[model samples]
Target: MSESITVAGVSVDTRHWIGGRRVASAGTFTDHSPIDGSAVGEIARGGPDEAEAAVGAARDAFPGWAATPRAERARILHAVADGVEKRTEELAIVETTDNGALLRSHRRGVMPRVAHNFRFFADWLLRLDHEDFETRGHTNHVSWDPAGPCVLITPWNAPLMLATWKVAPALAAGNTVVLKPAEWSPLTASLLADIAAEAGLPAGVLNVVQGYGSEIGDALTSHPDVRRISFTGSVPTARRIAASAAANLTPLSLELGGKSPLLVFADADLDLAVDLAVEQYDNAGQVCLAATRLLVEEPVVEEFTRRFTEKASALRQGDPRDEGTDIGPTIHPRQLEKIDGFVQRALAAGARAVIGGHRKDGQYYAPTLLTDVAQDSEIVQEEVFGPVLTLQTFTGEDEAVRLADDTRFGLAATVATGDRERAERVTARLVAGTVWVNCFFVRDLQAPFGGSRQSGVGREGGTWSFDFYCDLKNTVTAPEGWDQDHG
Candidate 1:
């Protein structure tokens, strides 16, 4: 039997997934498409009461899920990966419609990686090794155990993929989850719940609560039963979540936004640099790790800026569903306004716009390129998080390193240079969680992923993710007591 339900003339589910069922919500809220401002659907407006029930469900399911053998858990995770792969197109379309990501990018880049994340963690479970130590007269055994009920809050941009990043590892580590998807982009998460259930996730093992952060974020974060939390979003919201999680002394992993820098040296590969610079316009540049600050050597600054501006101007913005659309609408009207405001304020402060400096159509902002931006200007210091790129120049390696590390954010950076020594020296001094050498956004699931400083507080990838989602316990036993079945 199908639990498919529709609301507000949109064929979408508006229910919370609780206890392996699509549980009804106390209220509902409408979500509109950023592409055209049409009501995409109504989402369950989950609040404190709903959050409590979901946490209760997760808490009840935790012991059983944790007790399941590692092989069994691994099997279920593999099933989830299969399910995601089977419905790749469907998932891609839902994400595009709900979050305004280009259809091609979701289908080719994000959706495939969603399935890959699950598979990677499944494989990880099989290869997991615990810590062991030998003492003079005793043996110490250390193992990672599942934390109790957990709350995973995902941001609007790349909701499904980001949710998978937390959910896969948490489940692989044996933690039951209560996921709270951002209100502005809850449809794909609703679909994700369906897929997980269809993949044979046990009842109460995974739950979804869709609603405004203001109404339900605190409830989910501060819930007594939630032992761990992993959140991805703005710094302000992260601060609030940190405060709420502290009330119960719950553990938290926050992956906040970044004003990342991409540095290009005079001896760098200009072609590759231009290619990466143009990628700042990807997803309408609504990426936390997007290289918004372009710090180029003074000698090549003019050529790089001209080439980058031409590339930015060539990016076409239209319906996100279009196969050829290079740039799409931002998440919502407010974000579009915010992007324009950043450019306007920068222009007022003496920054000159080389290309697009305004909105193209309804909910669509033109791909913008700016130069002569001051180092201390808001545009450079703050994350624009839109299809806007600002250019700055540095005289040498010292100035480039100083300019790159000038912001409070230390999430990710890209260093493009032909010299291996230059890449090594520059990347070493760069204060970021992840640095790409001669490339950009090339993700490896096995590597540690997260940020430093104000960008984030914890890592989320491979072993780091397992460590965060599980609690390590040590048991020491005397050699005499360990004589049991020994030779």
Candidate 2:
């Protein structure tokens, strides 16, 4: 093992995990802290060769892993979860340092959820009982089997947490995996590989490949041995991955970007509605499901904007390591620039910035709220993926639903109303995979999570994940002359 090196107040290992061992890449790249321009650490950059090796390793391990007893698999996954819980603080620090997310949120929310995801999948899989259905003179046997060597490519926004969302279920379903962590945020992923090893995962079962998406992502997706691909990222990148996976006709489950809408009706509880709107600024609004487009009923538009903007403007922004900081700098300078560009374009298009409308040094963009933004404007239609909220008003429920579903992206949505019937009806009309009523971003481990239309193609979490990672196989046996009778 390479000696751990401290970078940007956290320790990181730059080596890539391949074939159950820490391997050095042929090239190296420097990681910069989004908190400042300082260097975070050096990371080994892997390419097509590394992707091939990782896939080969996974393919080599598949038979043994798949054949391993389900109880044993559950045990290892539980151990993995324990490992994560034990190192929660360290992992949270690494995540915040690498991804520029608030350390408080990482510790309180992301880390615990990461651990929960592993444990949930571990226990859930152990409880899944395969059954054989009886029929007249025939027995139909059904079972879930590993999808063979699989590739998981995670996004940078919530590195370790999202990594587990895919990794735990894939491993639990008995598939060997090659995980390609986003180049922008690889620290926690490298740490995760170590945690899995400590939990006694078999050699060549899970591999972590590090490098830019441009360098190794395509190779991993298109590798011949890879039977399935699970990716969480932007729509454009998802499209690219979808196309590459087509070479082998690989099965894919994508949880892509979102331009989620948060609708606040006149009948809604004002305090709760404002709270949900303010929550959008979390993680500097980089969350895929953050309420980027906020629609308010015309009667309550002014009051809602007042409360929401006040809360948004008061958000504390500083170093993620600071406990009191509510917002942190974006992941990189490029992301910061993109966010600034979105706000600027909105302003030029006649949108009025009610709170923040500017940027600072070292990848810091303020939590901004804008109004009078045209429904078809760039900021409203596109996923800003930043701390910029655009407000619009609807005269009635029908217009509100229409305005909410106006976008091509339908990943997640929210509706707040005191009337339960109205809430249910409005949520149903909104075309999103996950719709929140009187709440925002409250995820259930067992509930399906993903998007629709351009937002994404499939779901993750709980059974949806198991279904994605495992292929269902059915067998039928005919007794005596049953086949003749059936024919």
Candidate 3:
């Protein structure tokens, strides 16, 4: 590995991990922490050359990794999960330093989910049934043949946890990967490479190249050998990636931005709805699956707003490393500016800021809530991606469904209701990939997780992930007696 240094008491490698070794780039860039504009570390500035090298390494590793026994792959994945669990706090601190998310959340939820990603996918892969049914006296079997080298382009918001969401299944399905992590939070990805290596993952099985998207991202996505591609980012960036990947007709799984809704009915428990609304401020509302658009029924709208604003107003915005900090800075000052623009525009359009309406100190945007927002306002339609929420009221269930499905995004959503029939009726009409009845971000690894429409192009999680990472095939054979007689 490259020279190691300490940041937040965690040792992180600042060079590219290509071919299972530290590879220096011709240039370098310094990652500045958003918390206080501190220089976090010097990261490699990878370009087309580095992207090609990493892809080549993954390409070379694919055949052997695919041919290896399934059990060995699962074993190695479990070991990596163990490594992640052991270093949970260390990883959490590094992630907080790099991305400005709450260290407590990373430790309590994100890192454990990372470990769970690997373990769940590992065991799930081993349990896939490969055999067949007798039809017309003929046996038909299936196989999830490993695709060739793959490219995983992930976003910066949640860093390692999101990267592993793609990496775990890609590796477990036996495809070597070249992961290009978002430059803003690239540190933990290098650390993840170390974890996989220490867990006995074969060389060239997973590679990380860090650089600006303009420099190396297109090259990585458009490479000839990259058989499958998965990207999680903004729609504009996804468009650019789609254009580049179109040259080779590479299949893509795009999980883009969301302005997902959280619906609260009149009969819903007011405290529960308020708590879930406050939870959106988690990660400073950087979550792609966050229910940023809250649609509350008119009967309880006033009470709901009172409780939500009080709770949201009380959220502590401070150093992410502090266990009690409920909200942290946006990833960068530019992001803070973007978030502020949304709040300003909404206020100018006569919307009321019931809670926070400005940036806190350096990079932290206040946990702002917008009320009296028009259904078609730009703030309602656009994704602010900060500690912000928009509240709207509907008179009836039909209007609630209409308002919820009105966004261009359909990533994920939340529903707070007391009636089972109402929950079922509403969820069926809502166009999100995942919906929670009364909770927020409760993920089942085995469930199909993805978005619809502009939110994303395809799904991941469970067999959906395997279907993308592997080339599924079905083979049919003649009856055993007939084949033997012919032979």
lDDT: which candidate is best? 3
State in Å the error of residue 245, model 1.
0.8
Model 3 per-residue lDDT tens digits across residues 448-476: 88889899998898988999999999898
Itemize residue pairs with steric clashes in candidate 3. none
Report the C-alpha lDDT of model 1 over 1-487, residue by residue, as the tens digit.
Answer: 1234442233556788988888776578878888789886556787888889899999999999999999999999889889889988888877788889998998898999999999999899888887677899678997889998999999998999999999999999999999998888887777778888888899999999888888888999988889999999999999999999998999999999899999999998898999998987888999999999999999998899888777767777899888888988999888988999999999998988888888887998888888888889999999988989888899989999999999999999999899999888989999999999888888998999999999999897888888899998889887774556778
Q: Write the per-residue lDDT of candidate 2 for residues 1-487, one digit (tens) a residue.
A: 2435675456777888999998887788888878886777778889998988899999999999999999999999999999999999899888887889988888898999999988999998987666778789688987788889999999999998898899999999999999998888989888888999999999999999899888899899888789989999988899899999998999999988888888888999999999999998888888998878889999988888878767777788999999988899998888888999999988998989999899976789978889888888888998888889888898989999999999999998999999998887888788999898998878888899888999888887777788888898888888775455664
Off by over 4 Å in 2: 1-4, 8-10, 479-487
Indicate whether candidate 2 or candidate 3 has the larger lDDT.
3
Question: Each prediction's Cα lDDT score?
Answer: 0.88, 0.88, 0.91
lDDT of 3: 0.91
Best by TM-score, which number?
3
Candidate 1: segments with Cα more than 4 A from true spot: 1-11, 482-487
Candidate 1 clashes between residue pairs 3 or more apart in a chain or in different chains: none
